[model samples]
Target: MQTVNPQTILKEKFGYDNFRAGQLDVINKVLAHKHALAIMPTGGGKSITYQLPAMMFDGITLVISPLISLMKDQVDGLNTTGIPATFLNSTVDGQEQAQRMSDLRHGVYKMLYVAPERLEVPSFFSFVQSLNIELIAVDEAHVLSQWGHDFRPSYLNILPLLEQIPGHHALLGLTATATERVRENLQQLLQVTDENTVLTGFARDNLALKIIHNQDKRKYVVEYLRKNSDQTGIIYAATRKQVDELTTYLNKIGIKAARYHAGLSEKERQSQQEDFLYDESPVIVATNAFGMGINKPNVRYVIHYSVPGNIEAYYQEIGRAGRDGLPAEAILLYAPQDMHLQEFFVQKSEGSEEHKQNEYDKIREMNAFANTQTCLVRYLLQYFGETVTKDCGHCSNCLDTREWVNVTVDAQKVLANVIRMNQRFGKTMVAKVLKGSNDASIRKYEFLRELPTFGLMKERTLKELTRFIDYLTAEGYLQFEGAEFPVLKVTSSGAEVLKGQKTIQKRLEKIRIVSQSMNSDDLKLSDNDNRLFAKLKEKRLALAREAGLPPFLIFSDKTLLAMAKLKPQTDVAFLSIPGVGEKKFEIYHQDFAKVINEFIVI
Candidate 1:
């Protein structure tokens, strides 16, 4: 048996000098045998909380994870530190499962990761009860709540299984993004007290947020990738059809691209994920399912080809970028029609009435977010219950050099038409009436055709008029009524504007002066540092191939960029770098120093 402390295990195993903001507190609570919940942002070091205590505790620590790929990645990373860690899931065969069970009963491993659905199997539950499980850590704990963005019914089985164990065992829950309501749901479900819950702020200043109003999504994405050349990125579409189409378009244009979705076979999905992880293709065009298990840290940007249905999903998706604390960007290509697609999804999902209403509320909030003219980062932070007193100076809104337009005259015309039509039409009919279309719908309704406001906005295109209606809906000047095929109605606030009692202004994208370019040249490193970084990356790729691991597992791109900039020549100097601790330096210092020395001497 080995006698070790948490500090020693952290230093010797993970190669880091200290814990992240909330890690030490949760680790301390777990080591003291108390129930705790940690609400942290992505890349905030949630794994270390339970891992360190698992090493120090007497019996095995059980980790309940959502994805098998995540379990495998964690186990692989732990093996590099010479720690005994294993995973039990459907991916393993019967013989391997038997052997692993035998090894576990013999106390050969300190930690084991299992999926939540495993608890429902009577034999597996009985077998787990036989072991001396000292602690239980739930990863992605937000799945336990129906109010959460990614709800999994399997998570409800965890608490009952924990109760089935003979004695008291510590519980530690971790999630990357949970709203205040979802956090309360988790605490009540897990029996964790409010005092034991720790929330690290949800702001990632390294990631810039941008919303682009583009009609041609394929062309926009292609031009965006071309502008940010030679960088690793992900383009998330709303559906598999769009993903396949974009993948083909990028590949035809000589850009290496891969597509992933639920439609692919398990093997194909795994291969596509691995290709992106290994940098075979620096670009992956995928749906939301592509990123949950991915641990790649060098993704420079994340572009949403269509707006997501809710803010939580959007935050989690964009949080995948700038994971190493380097500069990154999140660009969302939004069109007024994206909202209709999201509404269809919300209506089609299986849920109770309250759940459906909640989903629709989230959709409206997301629409307002995409149509806002305020600081993008501030809007996200505030939505997540953080009080951001200052603006994040890097977002597109914060950096906007556009002039505001007075749309009071046009707004009055649109609102007046909605009123004159008796508030009985959807946006399409109103847009047609405003644009002076001679369609049958308008011709059949003589009253609508003869209204004074009809054709008031004939100079504008239908798309332009539809955008105005969406903007008003998002701003609460207009409201939609109905569960399906919602029709628009005028609010009292809108009536005032129509009567010339109030003014309306809009931050129209078309009127905004594009005085500056959107190129990422400002983020480029110096030529010398770029050369050194390239050499270091080559060495890392070779090391990763020899070890059969992802290159980021050796050292992240941010760590490599630091090495290239500082050009550390000694073990002590290398250890001073952010990602290099004593254990990692001892293993990789000489190889990296050799490369740096060669370049410096030249």
Candidate 2:
């Protein structure tokens, strides 16, 4: 086994001319017999780092993944691309499992997918140990770290079992989301130093991350689905009850949808999953249990019905959409109450005091995420330890077109009231004082009413004032000081305002759905091209139905959209499309070129 030009293999086999961010570096590290831990974003081609290297290896590259349900689809997709691969899981019958294992032993397949649980099985371990395992690649490698949000104990058996395997040449650990701590743990487990570690950073340029604050989550989701009815997506809820309720409400409103959760029977869950994967159901409402390894790449959007417990889970869930390198969106419908739900979860989770405290810390970070007026993409990337200065123009924060309103008088009123109260209260109490509320707290502090700024903002309601206070806090004019009962204090900038050296202006309103669909270079299709894309979609759906596969696996939406725009008629021209590899052209070349030819005629 030797290293060759990975770019050539990428184009000839995987149907791409360029290697994504960290794919080539990680691939080369392993091909040089160096163990590497690669932290790449979801849908960033992490599989190719190992898959391409495995094709060049003389022996089988065993991929250990925890996602058992997605193994069949992955293996099927590889087989369609003319890459010989197989998987051994509970879904395989005893006879078929034996046959696959025999084939694996005889080097009939370049790669084999297996769950991490297989490493602990005695018979399976004995057989796998005897084979010529050239390389072992662990997918979702964050599960190996105890500090990760989705950690699993089953991953503990991986390194111990691999120690005895003789033919394995190198180890690659791949994950989409990992903090500084998680990366350190993975490097230690993979026995790779930081020198060989490749990190492409956690930034999805193709995803427009939007945080919809203080909106009716259900109504927004329903309307969004109705508007984008022809597209496919997933809506994630915080609880199974929310999933069921949302599913029922959407169906009642004449929108076809399905629900998936751990509470459902295995058969029912499987059916819902299959519906979403095959595009029979355009949308799925589920809890965090739904999307781990399902590779339905054409998901146009992912709506978070509620706030996720941590950034890791949220990023991974949103990463499911636009997997085929197309423009998509991740809209998180955030409300103040979403914190209470996550706080309840943090309290109820089983962990030691330190772990609970860590969960609470993550909750606070998510709270900032929902409220921040800064660049959403920069905030997320910074959370994952990536240093990014420029704000990504794709996120809602960057796309926000609302003009700032002058609020210098309001700021003076708020800052004066905070000082009069000795900066001892939070936003709620301070806002109440400004609004001249008749609440008991205001009454208890009788002298508070005598202050000039106490009743200055009485024209506005308490809720409006509090939201203004929140905006000021997010803008750094105010800061919270405590955890249990956080109290807001005027920041240094606030003092500047009091000294008349600063002027205040606020974004008076939260953005509505006016910018729901953003313009991206890759997603742009002319009106006529869009019509052709729709026709190609119908043809793809029909072909998928006949072949018993998801339409995206046949040809991604990105590829179809490109073909429609270009109107390539010849077989050679069709093969020149971005997603068309040698094998893909060999299989579906005529089928797709005919559609473009027919469309071009009209």
Candidate 3:
């Protein structure tokens, strides 16, 4: 690869000192007219891959996107960075769009974003053919593959339009997630050969992976948010209904929050989004629809209320935080029921039997990461084909104080029982039979009367036995045959263990000791003190509403909490609270002092 002085361009145009990993190499390849695919995590500067090259090339760069809101956000962001950019989408009226097209013909735009449907119009095609086109960038390019999670039919027809462009401009495809199969589909669809392949390693070192297993997920989420108050964050739910419920719960608890989903009107979505960006609201409860082009820099946390369908989706969702090079948290609250929800998605997708089975198996593998007792970061890296020998120490599992025991004898007995039962039963029945539950299903199968290991293993609970099976699955000693009513199938490793040729060690997951004293320093605040802070916030909100501004704009919750705790009795003391700007001090300093004096005298 040829080297260019990226520093010069970075300083002159983007006001940056250097390029991120693999960015310079990809830019050089695209400028040389080689079609390429770039796979970088979200917030990894994928936009610059095509934007910088557009500046050096001869003609305009056309960016194809799926969301109008995302297009507007990108155009607005680029304009702020001193780049001459525009968008042609339905959000603009006919006259405005026509004027944009006229500007394009006159070479007024260096970068133009358009929706895939807009390319279907013949006039648009004719107009594009008349320009000196430089590059075609397909954002969210995974949508082109049927194997991907979010496939769009419009993307399938995009290649023909690329063929119609007058000049030989380079083609660039970008997405956060692409398995081996999706990568192949992208290459065939874009007609790119092997020589142009550009695969950036998918490891996101800055993110810490955590998985919390609990039956009552809402309770855990509420408790976490209460403890982490005064931080900007986002919570992603799988459905719009869940978003609504979570938004209500947060608001009732006095968190400045809003909801974003496709079910809302465009105006509502815009209003909520503006409030979030301006810090008028510190938390946004949203579905998957809210995060494509959001570029907020200081989001401190991303909490998943449900398990996403695949690891790719999980990675993309969590990538929204820590963009400003600060430490941020990604928390996953999972339950065994989440697997059923993911399986429903696999069953609903369109594919042949073999393809569907393959997708189902992939989901199982992704879920296995959640059930593992090893380091979470190591498991995530290994999924993307990177190896890490040492534990990250930051993940939940590495910090856990779990106990390990040699379950080799137990595993062998379980396998012998499965073979005795003819290897035709699912996990539920197998677990019941192993624990000697004598449930109706097990009794109907008559496994209760078997002699291999039926009633002898009655001491362990069903939950424990199932967890042990998951451990065996993770260790390659067992496999779940994905078919109609999938059942457990012993692998060669399992057979070896059954014959005493191998040993398997099982570690019991550690139980976290819930601190009875909620006043611990780590929790930040006690329940009663939090409620008192909420009361103070109520007064602040009323004042802000009277002033016709946001409560945070008046004074943040942190400022109010400080007031409630320290009882600042003077202007100087009030001004010392966090987020109290000069204007806020001028407006509400007297009111806060009055409250403090009243509390002191009482």
Local accuracy of candidate 2 as per-residue lDDT tens digits, 1-602: 85567788899889998888878889889998788999988888898999898889988899998888778878988899888999998889999999998988787999999998887899998988888888889898998887788777667877888888886478989999999988998888889999899999888889999988767676578679989999999999999988987787566546789899989987898899999989999999999888887878999999999999889899999999999889999999987677778878877777676676667667766776777888998989988998999999878888878987888878878888888889888778899888988789889888888887777889998878977787777677887775445677899999999889999876667545543222357568989999999998998999999999999999998888788887876654565566775567778877877877888888
Worst lDDT 10-window in candidate 3: 514-523
Per-prediction tally of clashes: 0, 0, 0
| lDDT tens digits by residue: candidate 3, 1-602 | 12546567677878878888878877887888878988787888888899888777768999998878878888988888877899987789999988988998898888989988888889887887898888989999988997776777667886888898987788899888887778889999988776776777666666677888754676677667778877888899888988987787566545668889999999999999888888899889998888887889888889988888778788888889887768888998877677787788768877678667766776777678778888887887677656678778888888776687888888887888777777777777777887877667876876456756776578888887887777778777778886546888888989999888998876665665653312325336566557657667877888988988888877776667666666665554565465665556767778777766755565
C-alpha-based local distance difference test score of model 2: 0.84
**Candidate 1 deviant stretches above 4 angstroms:** 1-5, 412-425, 430-456, 479-482, 487-504, 511-602
lDDT of 1 by residue, 273-321 (tens): 8898899999999999878756688999999999998999899899889
Q: After superposition, how far is residue 129 of candidate 3 from its true place, in Å?
A: 2.7
TM-score of each: 0.78, 0.74, 0.81
lDDT of each: 0.84, 0.84, 0.78
Model 2's TM-score against the true structure = 0.74
- For residue 495, model 3's alpha carbon misses the true position, in angstroms, by 2.6
**TM-score top scorer:** 3
lDDT (Cα, 0-100) at 369 in candidate 2: 75
